[model samples]
Target: MATINVRRDVKDSFYRYKMPRLLSKVEGKGNGIKTVVPNMTEIARALSRPPSYPTKYFGCELGAQVKCDDKNERYIVNGEHDAERLQTILDGFISKFVLCASCRNPETDIIIKNDDILMDCKACGAQNMADMRHKLSTYIVKNPPAQASKNQRKQRKAATAQTNELGGGFENEEGGSDDDIISQRINKEAAGLSMESKLAQEDWSEDTSEAAVAQRMRELSVKGVAAFAEDDDEGGESKYELFGAWLDEQDNNTISDDDIIAKAEELDVYGKYKACQVLVQCIFDESIAAQIPKRANLLRKFVTEEKHQKAALGGLERLVGLEYKDALMKKVPGILMKLYDVEIIEDDVFIKWGEKPSKKYVAKDVSKAVKKAAQPFLEWIENASEEEDSD
Candidate 1:
């Protein structure tokens, strides 16, 4: 029933992507002993890959024969194997097949072209060719999935619909001349425009009051700010300023997480980590431990990269380690566990962070003390990894 980060390398307990833990049951004995992955289909669904891919990957890695019965939803690898060993091999499959080389997100679709395998990332829109040196590429090329046929059918249907809509303009039941039909269409459009012009002239009005003028100016100013904020080329300045002004206008009351996420989307701040930096400062108080879980959705929406993840974690470090040091010291591990559960920080990121004092988040001494406080959780993760390796 336990779940782990989809990207096994990511140790964050709070990571948004997760998969059911690898489960294996050893069957038979002696030369006939084999490992059956009871939840191969479920894990493959979580990774957005076919169950056979990982099963074959295990076979290739372990030098054993494998059987993948798609109809019966059973995956078996020859020879005795433990869950921990198979789980480790699964990570290799994930790195080669699922994760995008360019953006590192696991949202990728495999493409086979010119006898080569390509990975197309849906998140960052990058195309990367799978290394042909891997044995799995040959299998994938030979046994391609059915997604391509479905996509082609959808495309053909869409093209037919578009052609029909455009073809409607030139239909001639009575076999009229092309020139005559064109002229008739032009005349009809001209008449409609003329009617619209007359209606516009009749509806014209002007408000000359000073109040109306002031209101119009305010509306225009707001519109200009919104336009600037939504312009992606303008960087985060406009978004930060606009969000700052909104926060300032809220008086002393806290803003709702939904409102914050909505505003971030409206301002086109989704991909920019700087917006996350600004959000952390404005949204949380001294007691960030209690607020982290509540605001996890917003964090997940914005923090997709290592930089953004580190930035958000750094913000939390400053909030808890500096402002509420005395109150949160004893609760540091629990707070970190919550962050991990929500996937705010990965294992490597958190472990590397706790290993040394970095001025990136706070003063040298404060960071050192914070990392020291997090030692217990770090040790627990290390111990777990050791146990898995021993198994």
Candidate 2:
């Protein structure tokens, strides 16, 4: 299937994170004309969003009624709409709900918390408020995400179990039911309890002392950077899986240089070029252009040899080219310049990465876009080197 970038505003032909080009089929005569989106499910999966969102959004934007039949996998907007018009409307939906407000990355989860909608970015770990003014917010609130729906089912099941237990057919010695016996017992106990005893039962004071905190940390078994216990006893996890798990446990915005280094060392993957690749992808976010300079010393520890530099570049390729393509593709040159200035990455590294697009790190198209974005910076490096030789 032909695909285009999710963010239609991105003009880069090689941009990653693409969804199927919207296909609309208009059916029926003039008065009863309706547009059907046959591939809404595929598009929604690519956007990491629900298909109903875009379908309903089309109705809201065009002031037309929309029908979303999930079981049948059919989405219809009431009108004779063309593909171009629907695609343009989809772009608006992506901007307002799909992309993270802070980092502009589309890897976000739409959550309804306390009747308000929020977009939680997997890349930046920022919880941004979604536009509540939009009419779709009401629909989203009424029908929360699948995770929330599952939680609700669990709650209902628990409640049913409790009801079954209390309303069971067990008869007491006095011929009363479990519910009646339990109610009478509760009333008797409440009459007998003193105010001081009730107060003791209601004690909610937490143990916040230093010793208590130390005990909690010990129980967590903090061994360097591993959040939970190692899977060595489980006996199937590879070293790379272990490293990946540790990285997954970390919060991108707050992970410090010391923790990254300590964890890498503890895992005995400190000097491995592959480790550098994993580190760069997991630690950096859309703010990577600014973060590169700040973490120059840390990056230097990993990006020493040309091979390590290449691995680091691969990480960046996946991060910017694929993860945050729309937001970071244009900033590739400045990011490369920052790395060069900080001495973490050399001129040769840029030249080598820009020589050709490789599918080693990201999709071929995405790699091409990133390399293409670095052209201006690569040219400047060559010009500077020529001037130095002349001097």
Candidate 3:
């Protein structure tokens, strides 16, 4: 009944994430030899993934047949296998499907969108598309988890109910029904020889005097200003414009960090972590290694959660992956170490980024090279983690 961290890469004994150790029993004999996982359901529940996913993954890895009996809750892999070997294979499934690509958290749910499978992290709110190159992805796409289907149905029902509530009611008239009022208004509008009236009205134009024109222009100006003010009150200044202007002012040393924070609040960009995105975009140009400490204060102020951290990292990735690929390919470890030293990014975040080279944020070749450059740091962290585990 011993439990271990869901992510074996994490060596913290007090790590919040855990699952029961893999248990297996060899069954049958000779030609009919197989392995049975008695507690697969319990392990799957702890990992927040379907039992079939791991069961099928084992088969794919071992080049054997597998059977998943949902009705009986029995998962069997053909050919005799030991618990230790199966557990190693299970780690592959955990990394590919259960763990969040951004935060490396196990609180993830699989979703199907447009026939593509995606892993959505409840912890970080990152939607990462599953690598379709894997055989298990095809299985997941064709046979999605039942919980996702139920949630989709629930969402559809809630949306339909909201639509009904918004469009259901009719305004009550004081004297008559809405239909009667509409009918009367239409009749009055159409009354009294419309063709003759139209001909007469064509010849009778309104005043075109300079005074009249000036008065009309004044009225329009007043209304336009009032409408603009109302819109400003509701939506505030455009966030992009405000952030851009603040960045320009900062380059000229006309504004302090306090000034920018206050302006972000006024622009309604502080609470949602939009300021962190802007700060990343503006503070670091082609090189972020030396600027990590300089912008650490801003990152700490705004990047409070995994989502915000991921967004800031995303901006950095764009800066390096697009414009400074050579620099990233050379100094990835130094840049990552600087970010880690400043506590701007977490170990898991960097580890996950280094483990998988994502084309979503950078070119495939660039992502690969960047990740390759980060191997030394990644290996150091892994060794450090093992040392921690030993202690």
Candidate 4:
């Protein structure tokens, strides 16, 4: 009945996400021996994934047959695998399937679109593609999760309720009359709250409107993120272009990170997220993998948020995928490893980047080529993460 962190890579004792420890028992003898997982249902419940997924994953990884007797609530894998080894394999399943590629949160729903498998994260709103090259992906596509239907029903119910609220009516989508008395009672209770109490419950400081965000940006004044502000007004685009021009003029051999910061501040684009993209594209060339360690501190300074990390990745995509495709494309994996080693980019960010191609920085085909070249490093990152968890 022991529990372990759902994300084995996360060693925090107080981690909120957890799953029941995998329990394996070997049954039969000789060629008839098989490993039975008595608690797989419980484990899958905790992970919000179908129990069949991990079972099939075990089969695929170990090159053994897996059997599931759902009515009897039993799952088994061929061969006499021990609990310790099975646990390590389970960690790999969790990393590839359950955890979000962007936030590493275990709260995700499996979504299949066309030939692609995607993990839609509830924590960070990032939709990450699963590694379809894995043998389990084909199985997952053939047998979608049962919860998908329930999720669709929930969405429909929420939509109907929202329509009722906005239209000031108690009727549902099917033209059926809702409970008039209950609706009146709910309205009466809502009307009973004092305006002062409502005002007290509201937190004005957390305003995320455009005006508020613009005001904050103005007050902060080009620390290093102004170039990547969410605003895309003509003035903002002009400032970004000017910053890019200035960055193109700097010599990578002589210009220090401090000098870059000073110029960014002078140009009033220091704190913008897009500034990271421009800097990365202009600062590094074919020798980017080798130069990353030397300029890792500068990257750390700019990549303060997820969006900034995304911009930096976009820059790399442009550099390797577009500008120097022949020279640097083959080295994409090593380049990414260097970025990871120096902490210039995080595992989640790069993993998400490698899962799919984006055309925001480079051509769609070029973006795909870049990600294709990075597959080896991406697999290494996932494998290394699982191995770390085993320790």
Each candidate: RMSD: 16.0, 21.8, 22.4, 19.6
lDDT of 4 by residue, 179-287 (tens): 5345545655676766668888887777799999997875465533454545642446656776677678878889888888887777666656788888888899898
Tell me the tens digit of each residue's lDDT in model 3 across 1-391: 4699887866656454679888775643446567778668879988867889899999989999999976546688999898889999999999898877776767678899998988886654789987889998899998898675677546545533332333423433221122433444444566656866888868667789999999888557544433353332254335544565557567623445667667566555663544565667666765577767766655655665566666666666666667677656578778778877765665556666667777755677866776787789889876765565566
**Candidate 1: where are CA atoms >4 Å away?**
1-238, 241-258, 286-290, 389-391
Query: What TM-score should be assigned to candidate 3?
Result: 0.38
Record all residue pairs in model 3 with backbone atoms less than 3 Å apart, i.e. clashing: none
Candidate 1 lDDT tens digits, 1-391: 4789877765545344579889876654456567778679889888867899899999999999999977656688999999999999998898889888875667678888999988987655789998789898899999876574566546544533332333424423321222433444555677799999999889468687999999898667656665665444455376666675665566324667668767766665655666666666566665666877777756655665567666776766776677778887777788888878765565666766677788965898887887788889889866755565566
Clashes of each: 9, 0, 0, 12
The list of candidate 2 runs beyond 4 A from truth reads 1-237
Q: Please identify which of the two predictions, 1 or 2, would achieve the higher lDDT against the true structure.
A: 2
lDDT for 186 in candidate 3 is 48
Model 2 TM-score, all chains together: 0.40
Deviation in Å, model 2, residue 39 alpha carbon: 55
- Name the regions of candidate 3 deviating beyond 4 angstroms: 148-391
Q: List the pairs of residues colliding in candidate 1.
A: 11-347, 12-346, 13-340, 13-341, 14-340, 14-341, 14-342, 14-343, 15-343
Q: Give model 4's TM-score versus the native structure.
A: 0.41
The alpha-carbon lDDT assigned to residue 387 of candidate 3 equals: 62
Please give the lDDT score at residue 372 for candidate 2.
90
Q: Assess each prediction's global lDDT (C-alpha) against the native.
A: 0.71, 0.75, 0.69, 0.77
The candidates, ranked best first by lDDT, are 4, 2, 1, 3
Candidate 4 stretches with Cα past 4 Å from truth are 1-235, 389-391
